[model samples]
Target: MSANPQWDISKALMVARFFHLLCGARDACVTPFLTLYLRQMGLIAPWVGILMGTKHLIATTWAPICSFLAKNYQKRQLLLIGSLLGSAAAGLLLTLISPLDKALVYRFCNGSSSLMLPINTTLEKELAPNHSAGIKNFTIRTKRSQVNSRVMMGKGNPQRSMFETTDSSLPLLHVGSELKTPGTLVNLSLAERTRAQDRSLALSLGEHWLFLLSMMAVMFWELLSAPLGPAAADSLYEYLDFVDATDCYRRLWVWKLLGMSIGVCSVPVLVVQLDCFLAEDTPRAAVHFYGYTAFSILALPVCFAIPIPNFKRREPGHKAIKALSLIGNDCLLFLLAVTVFLTGATVANIENFLFWQMQDQGSSELSMGLSVTLSLVGEILLHPFKAKILKNLSSLGTLGLGLGCLSGQLLYYSLLWNWWAIFPAQIFGAISNGALWWAVDALVEDLVIPGTERSLSVMLRGLFYGNGASLGSFIGGFVVLHYSLAVLYKTHCVVLSLWLVLFIAIQSKLPQHRKINYSKLLAVDTADASDSEEGAERDWLIKAMRDEHLTGRAKNKY
Candidate 1:
């Protein structure tokens, strides 16, 4: 690569799109099947939960470190290294090993290799010729991929209205419009203008193709991984005695739910794809592992093909300080973190409790699968309306509504013993999980500075979902062991009620509009800006900071 490389954006995007698709394909083959893999290895309930939690814990721990490294090192180089290491780790899974040893290797590989996605996303943003155009392309492509995935899964076409909703929010080009140039238009021929338009259209089309490739990657992966979990659970059930099987299955689902929640909140790059080899049949396990390993190896060259512009390394000292200061200064962020944590715990508890409750009532694995599938469908259908919901209700109000829906679902579940009734309750699950998480995502974006979004996003995921799931899994497991699922539901309701009260209190105090005082927050030198307009902007910035607890030293820094 040239030292001063001016890459063709269209070609670069094509490479990126293909790379992401390969990544999605590889992960899809592995994650949802992990629980069954472990079961095949003869691991039981709490151990499953422990292993699942460990993976999240490792990933969460490594995310920040990786983020820092990506900033300072060549991103393409890091991608190459991560891909190679990941392939090696996948191959290692084929070997005979103790359960503990396998879990350790899996954690190391999963956590370290997971850096590729976030790094890739950041690299995409850096390389995009036009950020708004890229965002639009990404949204469109993701929607198309989602539709394709649903169709393949035998779900019918998604609502056409969803396309309209997504388009309305995205920035779109108005085609057939005349271009305004600085020079005299009379000097330019009609054919020249037409050529310009064609070039513009070509760029747009390239962006679309790029995004389509990325989404296809995700869609294909989802298709491969979706059925693996339920199938694995069924397989595991056959191996154990009835009582042990029920307990193991419940724990497996709980860990799976926790893993999903963490993956959603944490690293955009890291996905949860885990499967294990059969303990008794080493040969079969080797075959399964080798198949995935070969696929993973095939993905390596594709990683090298992605073209990311080199970035100069800056000392990351300011990163650490900025992160610490933001945490200390941002009270609302702290409260939101707490709210997400409690809310995650409540969701995890209720989901596990409800699933087992239905099963205990004689619901077959098929029925449980249908319930999960429908719930996922509901969530997907609700997603397009997320921006509108936030617009009308505000982030806090949307969250409140989601919490209310969750509360209602829990209440309904408590009152009914019938398994079928839970399906309708999934409407509540869909709204709460979908809308609430979206609200939180929006709120985080509004609260933080632009450069800090990735770190904050990872932090929130770890605090709210990662630690929350770990805590919930341990607590839920012990409670189920000692007490009844009914008891767990009752406790969940009370806890959420108390959390709602606290959330309301915090929401009341937050500024209705989330404007930050960058002058004070960033400590920009404004001494030269003595003009009235610049002075006024600086004054407004200071006041905004003051409202959020600006210190005397901070105020003077600018």
Candidate 2:
């Protein structure tokens, strides 16, 4: 146990916080604009689709590189160097457009930056601890188990929720029966599952790396910039030891490397190709491009101000807040899953709907870019309100508001035909995204110990995001290929509605810790205690050594 209970923010944390902020800003700048950039470069839609697919492939393996780097370099230094390298590459790419230059920059920024994913994961995991000694390790292990269990169950059912079917025993028998009864219908064994998983991961590696680099830079900047309260560090050291440096680094690397697989499989391809909706060199096209970037940039700082309860550090006034937050977390995750699914499908089908809208409006590529830019502008406009909403409402309330707005946006999209009408939806998207992201970060940070494990929490977040995005993208592609865009959009509306209902239903059951004096318990106040303990221990050791020396002299004289 640490002699002092309070946590002090370290230099590494400062480095990480700044990096995360940069990542968020970068994501806002890049992701929504990449497809249009591809169009600018004269790539056709099919190649664009291939590039979109490849982004996820790179994202999925991002963590392994972090792990490998951690083995040889200081984590903080590596992050700094990575960012510098990526930034330089991005700048160079803006000026230089040859295939070779694009490839090099893309590999440096997008390909290698995946390494940071695991580092972030480890940081989040290290942050969630209390005063109890060894509590963090135990909690991390438990959290891992729970996450694995949920994933396994999710994989097994594929059609049902884990909560719906409490029976875990039936899947094995069902699998076994399938194996016995059929040739083509046979269930896969563990070996086959591993093989399939490997193949899926392997398939993502070959897409255009440059575009992925842009998106990766943007997202990572967002993550790096979000603020870290003192509670994060205090809680982390309470449970984890950094002394066994190799083990510490290794543990941090494990999930992130694995998490990259999640990213490679997650990006929504249709979203990347949204530029096809307009002809080249028009105001609307520029609007689309700028609007997306603007929204992302505005969303990050606003999200930092949103106040979700830190359930990990118990507060005094909000006794029931913890319980409410737990229910809220579950609800939020459910909604988020649905949101990802629907959004992905909509993005995939957007080209279908926009093709007509573009024809009707005679929208050019510049117009299309402008439309994207306008959406981003609208999103930017709404970012400021996020802090206020979070502070005044319960965490769940804030989430509900965001989701409600998001639902309205979807409905608006469904009812309207004008490309200009998308402004309202984009504005709402900014708020929705800010609030939703803050809610998730707060929820996870609350659940875990704060210090060293905070990174793990972040990593897990990436995992969930990567998983949802990959699956959503994959499903969206199939839906667009087979169904009309209208069908896809309407289907998304239905999923969002279902998500809301599930959140309402399941929100009462999860565990929550009321607001407590978490800061008091965390190691913030350790200045006095640590000094006193060290002084006393040093004095005692010195006296003991003196007594031993005196005894040796007396015995020799006799």
Give all candidates' CA lDDT scores. 0.49, 0.39
Q: Tens digit of lDDT per residue, candidate 1, span 1-558?
A: 343265444444444444444444444334433433443333323443454444444444544444444445645345454644454463453344333223222212222222111121011121223433433334333444454344434534233233323321122211111222223123435574454445445544644453344333323333332232222222233223222333333223323343333322222122223332235334223333444455457656755554444435344546545655676677777777777787767765564445445533444334544565566567767767877999999888888887788777777777765768778887888888877777777877787776676456546665456677657755764555455455666677777777888878866765554646464555865566556876767674556666666543443453
Model 1, C-alpha of 211: deviation from truth (Å) = 42
Error of 1 at 500 (Å): 1.5
Error of 1 at 502 (Å): 1.6
Lowest lDDT block of 10, candidate 1 = 115-124
- List, residue by residue over 1-558, the lDDT tens digit for candidate 2: 243234233433333344334433334344544544443333323444444444443454454344323323424333434433443343333323322112222211211222111221011112122222132223233333354456546457332233233221110101122222324233446675454444333322322453455445434532232212112222233223332222332233223222222222222222333432233222122333343334334334433422212223322333224433433444344444444444443444343234333322233333444455454444445556656766787567766666666666556655656546654566666666556655555554444434423343433344444444445445544443354334545676677667767776666553333322245446454454435666766554454556656755653554
- TM-score (C-alpha, index-matched) for candidate 2: 0.43
Best by lDDT, which number? 1
| Residue pairs in collision within model 1 | 31-273, 31-274, 34-274, 34-275, 37-276
